[model samples]
Target chain A: MAVPTTRTARRGRPGYDLESLLRIAVKLFNERGYDGTSMEDLSRKLGITKSAIYHHVSSKQELLRLAVGRALDGLFAVVEEARTVPGRAIDQLEFLVRGSVTVLADRLPFVTLLLRVRGNTKVERDALAKRREFDHIVSALVEQAAIDGDIRADIDPATTARLLFGMVNSLVEWYRPRRDDDLHTIADTIATIAFEGIRLPGGE
Target chain B: MAVPTTRTARRGRPGYDLESLLRIAVKLFNERGYDGTSMEDLSRKLGITKSAIYHHVSSKQELLRLAVGRALDGLFAVVEEARTVPGRAIDQLEFLVRGSVTVLADRLPFVTLLLRVRGNTKVERDALAKRREFDHIVSALVEQAAIDGDIRADIDPATTARLLFGMVNSLVEWYRPRRDDDLHTIADTIATIAFEGIRLPGGE
Candidate 1:
């Protein structure tokens, strides 16, 4: 029943463009994994031929590059956005943290694929390098935040940054956006829990 | 270069037991991913024949089962150990958090595989089921702790548990056993940062 509905929906669609093709490809990649997936799998999933998939993207690696690149672009943009401009380093860090949750929520599947890439291919290796760069940028913010005495000073800034973002990144594991609890609510919850430990003010 | 050293090291040893084989398999699984790895790959990496590999473990799935089962056993043992016995719910929660980090560090590869399994196979599904059970137990502790006024009440206990473990679990991503920093040190840092927000006690 659902399969027929999906088939009919795709049939009703006018044409497959690069964006739409990439979306379908990413879904397959995430489901079966990048290595496990092939152009034949994408074609089968999309109810199209291998040539149709190639017409949009030269190779499976090209689809992976585009998909993960979309996620990476969103993340790097968050760091550069005027709103994320440096105020206090801690404030900037908080903005990045919150902005990241929003990005993860908005581009969940793409970011999920981005996080799971194992550096098995050139495209994957590039994605991992970019990810490390992002982490380094955030870690620097953490160092500045500690130096400014905005956050705790005892823990190493690099470790602090990784753990903080780890809490944020874990969202990709289970966070599902719903109508009642929107992305903002999820992001705010994460920011609060991360910065303000789960303890109430004045509680021991 | 390293391959001969590994083979020589293994051959110098007398007993080739199940535990040792699982460790090698888990390392391969983590490196190439479970689905991406094959028995031939394991044999090549180990410098052993397929028959020799099968002599220890009947199949790759059996190896995966034993590897993940070892990790799950370690974790479950932490929960059941007299040291983690009933106490202030908050204290119990703290013990579990710290113990989990130790387990992660001690059984890094196996736990890494456990965490990454996507329930694609029967062995993977079983591992995921046990993982959910462990999460449920920890979440219950969080709930009890919140009820006892030990932790904050704003966020759901289950979500708090996930995020807390998320921070701990992220250790597998970058943590390497170093001479200066030991597992206890890593565990202590995670506990302090987690329970006491990175912000100093008096700071905003």
Candidate 2:
């Protein structure tokens, strides 16, 4: 769910904003971990009252949902946008991979936090469900690519999709965004390794 | 870092063993994060007194070290074994990927626990150091393969290694061992996607 930018858009807080609050919460969540971070800790870090945090969001879980949701939404948006690529499934799959790298670079913290969740809470479970949906979409794209004779048919499509995304998703572990231009290079490297690796010999 | 099988193999407890304790510790750590689980939790899970738990290992951190150490040791052993393979670096790289999949499958819980650590504790930092060492070894091998003209020269070897191992390491998330034979199939799939991905056309 899109977190309302403010409790009410017309009456804006002069000093603290909801987006800033969410950003700090996410940073703390990423650093100390979701379970380890408390609202009181957020208050201490943000130099604001817990009452102010509640005024913006209902609970720590809400912050988590918004943070994790941004990542899932970005990925699903890539999926939906990629659906409109007017070409073979393999082309669309490459677009999906490249777009995902951009989203990850753009929303690194959110995606990093999303990757770390283990379905422990309701929020985590919901995030995981969305992730599974995204995985299914990628797997379907791989199968279609195989049927189109664009990629190797020997590997199981689901496994191929998993391994492909495994490499993509792994960027969250080590990649630190040094430049905006680096995203495309990273995307190309991954796509070249993944798609070209799986592609049949003819298109080369 | 080999955990002595028992305090003494000859004088084993009739009901429990260190292996079983480490296994249970790993399960709980995976289920309810290492930081979240307490000594009391372990004692209750094992149906033993906290004193008994202490008698076996110095502290919870020791359990974590032992647990994560198993994964690192298993991986390093694979690294050492792959070194003896006499072939082009590309061939050896494929062997490393396949052997890693086996290690991950055989030591699923330990490897799972290892991936989740964030270096918050000294034990965790040590584990991360070992992981980096493993990654460095793989990257060096990839560099050699690239220099040997077995793989693509356009991509950076370290990034290639990261992406390759990322795909292999991700098996820990969704892959549950069904049959021992499936391990071979899984390993072949990873090697195909990774090595063939970077392979020169015509296999020259």
Candidate 3:
């Protein structure tokens, strides 16, 4: 593969392009898992020396940070955009959940790794901290919805938020994007089941 | 610690009791995570040599197998009992969901480890296979419930099962056994929200 003009010489040519390196890293991370992946393994996969990888990124943890940050940035952006939307609390929550699912589906590998990382490394820990902040934002929305009588008040907001994300996070586990499974359809299905629920609201 | 056994070891001593070793192993597995833990770490934690651990179990993978098998057994039993219960499909599913939550809270550490494993080892692979089987069974139940016209037909059964288990699995992420947070109470809350949902029935 040809190195793009953006690359700089660091003693020698960058052994692998940055874009190729990231795609390979994400694939390996998904395959062997984040903790199971090693620098040597990544080098072997990319047909590049370990030094070549170091020239591109400092370490394996740096790769993880780059990958999970992609997912986290997508999620936090959804929360930020949804909060500004003019609607009822439930409507805002609906927009947030649907948009989040679409992001998760689009960035499946990155978000899958993000969800699985248990803070074993600094990168993983930072990802988790940011993840908790996102959860807090969603939980606050659930709290507002509950207070507005848009949602049931019997359950605590934190528990409700956990349940909501639980439903959303499971998307990473089972959502295989088919040629037919468009984001709009997937997001609509998730939102409908989430808001109105699997029970027919009118008479069931 | 004094060796309580009446029989003396032919070697230096009976290094560590099996029960005590298991307790320490489970604790370490929970703390460092299963993939991150090593035999050397386990030995140091037990204050015993690596060879001494081998005297009880062949390998670290054996300990993982034992730990995950205990959790898998609990989950499979819940599904089996649910299958035999005489009721409509939704009722049986409700029973299974509550039972699984109770088992999960009861065996929090083991199930937490089981949930986190990424098929990096043979033991992990086996655990993942069993987990998939359990998911399949639950999906079948979800389908049956939908067919019976209990759950709405619009949402796919597989998706609903994922949503249901997602709610159950999130318990491990945050749930702590507090004085106020009883297991049955939490299980009841999960089932209620899962089935009836957070929406007030009949618009209150």
Candidate 4:
């Protein structure tokens, strides 16, 4: 795979690093469904030959595995960190929520790809398995929180966890990062709404 | 375009009515994206000739148009009903949340298709525009509710509205309908989480 001299790297991505290559691959996979996108498509988009792409990543499946791995890694890191928080399950849950919003925001493309995985192949199936594991951890937290009288016991903990993360996971869809947007404020709002409720005290 | 006598509609879809055809088409579009799905594929799945399938809907784009229309119309209908609720803005917002959930659950496939549109074509662009209009209406309700001192005014209303609906919209991804699952219980859970929140009263 002869490295193209000039025209291929017109986007200033000439001599692409693995990180840059992975980012572009994830973006393409998200825009075009994993099944819909082809190796030729990725090569063309990257302005490199197919062999050049294969040099960095063994296969398209490897590309997907790497991208979703980055996202899952970010999420699990938060879960691991929250596990050490010194408080009740509610406290850990809040920490997870804040940490997750930061992960989704920081690694939006990778997380977006992770969220869209549909288990079409071995790589996707692994990602889905990891995701279920993550969900189980969250549900356990919610269940423990409910038992401690910290969270509402009226709702099933599993259902409660789904809705809680549903709101936070939604950032990939509509949350465009703006210059002035505050990540802490965003996390604060999620915690506020999730814990304190959005309706004024007397109004509810 | 004479219809074949036998094996085409192996799924018991022989002689598909427009409703049945629309449902199957939406399902296929969801499974294999609209661009990836061919009319021949639909005809093969329906046990009809391509021309016979075309006799019902003018084009695949029409199928997409109709599919997304069903989903958008369901959402708009909820908005209209919410408008008729003679109460505070918070009340209307709650109504919108519940109604939207019903729409999503009842028409899961259509709503799923609606959420995945990426504005690649005229039909998609139109659907995206309608979606924005729907978001604006919901944001207005949130803003008004905040001004009324019913909703906490600290967070931006638009941001709040996005997160609220994000939770509802997520039903398409994970929510599976079972005969024993009560719809009201689900709606109550969403309303409770969005308005009253998940934490116990004194937990904060």
Best by DockQ: 4
Ranking by TM-score: 4, 2, 1, 3
Q: Largest lDDT belongs to which candidate?
A: 4
Q: Proportion of native contacts found in each model?
A: 0.51, 0.41, 0.38, 0.75
Structure candidate 3, residue pairs in collision: none
RMSD of each: 6.0, 6.1, 5.2, 3.4
* CAPRI docking class of candidate 2: acceptable
Interface RMSD score of each model:
2.0, 6.3, 3.3, 1.3
Ranking of all candidate structures by their lDDT, best first: 4, 2, 1, 3
In candidate 2, which residue ranges exceed 4 Å CA deviation? Answer: A1-14, A179-181, A198-204, B1-14, B178-181, B198-204
Worst 10 residues of 2 chain A by lDDT: A1-10
Please say which candidate is ahead in DockQ: 2 or 4: 4
Q: What C-alpha lDDT do the candidate models reach, one value each?
A: 0.81, 0.82, 0.78, 0.88
lDDT of 2 by residue, B1-204 (tens): 233334343244345578989999999998878888998888778766676777788989999999998998899888888889988677677888898898999999999999989888999999999988988898998888767766777887788888888898898888888844477777878878775562324221
How close to the true structure is residue A71 of candidate 1, measured as C-alpha lDDT? 94
Compare candidates 1 and 3 on DockQ and give the better one.
Answer: 1
Better structure of 2 and 3 per TM-score:
2
Comparing 1 and 2 on DockQ, the stronger one:
1
lDDT of model 4 at residue B122? 99
Tens digits of per-residue lDDT for model 4 on A118-150?
888999999999999999999999999998998
lDDT per residue for candidate 3 within B1-204, as digits (tens), equals 122323322255546777678767988887777766888898777666676777788888888888888789999899889988888888788889999998898888888888878787788998999998988889888888888888877776766787789889888878887746777767766776677666554332
The 10 consecutive residues of candidate 3 chain A with the worst lDDT sum are: A1-10
Quality class of the docking in candidate 1, CAPRI style: acceptable
User: In angstroms, how far off is A169's CA in candidate 3?
Assistant: 0.8
